[model samples]
Target: MEQSFLAYLRGRTRSLPSVAVGIGDDAAVLDFPINGQPTAVANEPGSGVLQQVACTDQIIDGVDFCSESQPLASIGYKSIAINLSDIAAMGATPTAALVTLALPAHNATEIAGEVYEGILEACGQFGVAIAGGDLSTYDGPLSINVTLLGTVTDPWLRSGAKEGDAIFVTGSLGGSLAGRHLRPIPRIELATRLRQIATVNAAIDISDGFSLDLDRMLAASRVGAELDIENIPISEAAQEMSQTSGRTPLEHAWSDGEDFELIFTVGESDAIKLEQLSADELTTAITRVGTVVGRTGLWKRVPGSKLQRVFPQGYVHGETDE
Candidate 1:
């Protein structure tokens, strides 16, 4: 339903010439020309032009979190962290953020201050400044919206993957609802280091499930993927969640949402280089989970079984399949 609504919105919208990427990806990339010159020159240094990447996200009480149970500070931190994850996916340097809040009518002032404390904490950690935003009171659940802005020389887009490219993911996955969801560590520094090392063909943050987000990237790239089940990193949180969830840790790792880790594709040579990088160089571990294929859907291979089709499954707003 989210996809369907996005499709509808896409059909009705018309992109401007400055818009390099308008919709259907992690963020929108827009070209900002300097000194009345086109910034389309390839490999030109000191061109005084940059692509501005922008993305916005909203979190509401009762849906994203329960205000009564969860700490407001965590909620505020998460609002900024999630947007930073989007910027990380684009391999961009985050600059500033505009945050809007809809506070509850009762105790609105105190709640707003607590939320801002969390927001400011995250912003300071990331070197981002609070640009500007609006605030208001509402009878409905509290809602916080953040619009993040970043700059990139050449944005890593989702449509650049090629057949035979290797699929890589940073950090472990799954069981985000086990308290990891509120404090996401955005891969901004790691993504910057990766840009310095290898050429990322396509990239996306696993905000939804791994399978679902990978499927989105594959669809954008017009390619398919074949994942090695054994290679996928299942987190300890996933293992803990599996005990009573009646599901395998691998299953949770594959389908859980809000992992906030990056899933990117690279050529074979780059993949080899990345795999050879030492822990000190990477700071964070990256796993080669799969490979891009010429087909048009997702497939997975177990150790002893043939490749089998895997449907994209994850959290979708306004819908429930759990």
Candidate 2:
């Protein structure tokens, strides 16, 4: 419903000349002018050409985190990291951020300061600056909204995927709720390295679980995916948690959101190059877990069975767990 509503609104309006991308994908791309003139930079290194990419993410108490259990610094760090993930999904370098905090009237100034410290620490790590933001007192829950701005000469989009492309995911997935959800390193450097070696057909930061986010990429590209269950990388934490949860590690990897890893598709040939390059560079480990197909939904094929349709099982706003 959220995607459909956004699509409807996007279809109703036309993009302006300066708007490289208005809706959909990880972030919106804008061709900002320099000195009051329109500028479109060529996708070349050291070309002084750049386009702006922007995205926002929000988190709230009770829903995103329990303020009582989680440290204020961790909360602030997460708020910024989530937005940076969106920027990184576009294969861009984060430049600045704008934050908005909504807190209860009884909140103390020290808590606010600690949150700012965390935000500052995250921004410093990513080479991003805190440009500006807003603060407001709310009667309800505490919420943090972050808007991140970035720049890329050639931004990767989710709509460019093609049939027969190889699907890849950086790092392992699942069990973020245990600890990683609070402190995740945005794959900004890894994404930049990916673009340097190969042509990434489609890309997205995996926050809404592997299956659901991959479904979004396929939907945008009008393609289908055939996942090899054995190839999906399951993290150590996921494996450990699965022992007590009665769920398989693979299940947790597919359904548990907030992985914050990069899921991208590359041409079959480029996929090979990417593997070799990553190995040589000692970059983040990536696994080829699937392939882009001709059909229009998500699927998985077993060793001996036919393709099986898979529905999204990730977290959804206003939707109860099964």
- What range of 10 consecutive residues in model 1 has the weakest lDDT sum? 40-49
Which candidate wins on lDDT? 1
Q: Candidate 1: global Cα-lDDT?
A: 0.90
Summed backbone clashes in each candidate are 0, 0
For candidate 1, write residues 67-172 as lDDT tens digits. Answer: 8889999999999999999999988999999999999899999999999999999999999999999999989899999999999877888888899999999999
For model 2, how does the per-residue alpha-carbon lDDT over 130-154 read when each residue is reduced to its tens digit?
9999998868888899999998876
What TM-score does structure 2 among the candidates reach?
0.92
What count of clashes does model 2 give?
Answer: 0
Badly placed stretches (over 4 Å) of model 1 are 15-18, 36-49, 302-305
Clashing pairs in 1: none
TM-scores for all candidates: the values are 0.94, 0.92
The top-ranked prediction according to TM-score is 1
Evaluate residue 159 in candidate 2 and report its C-alpha lDDT on the 0 to 100 scale: 85
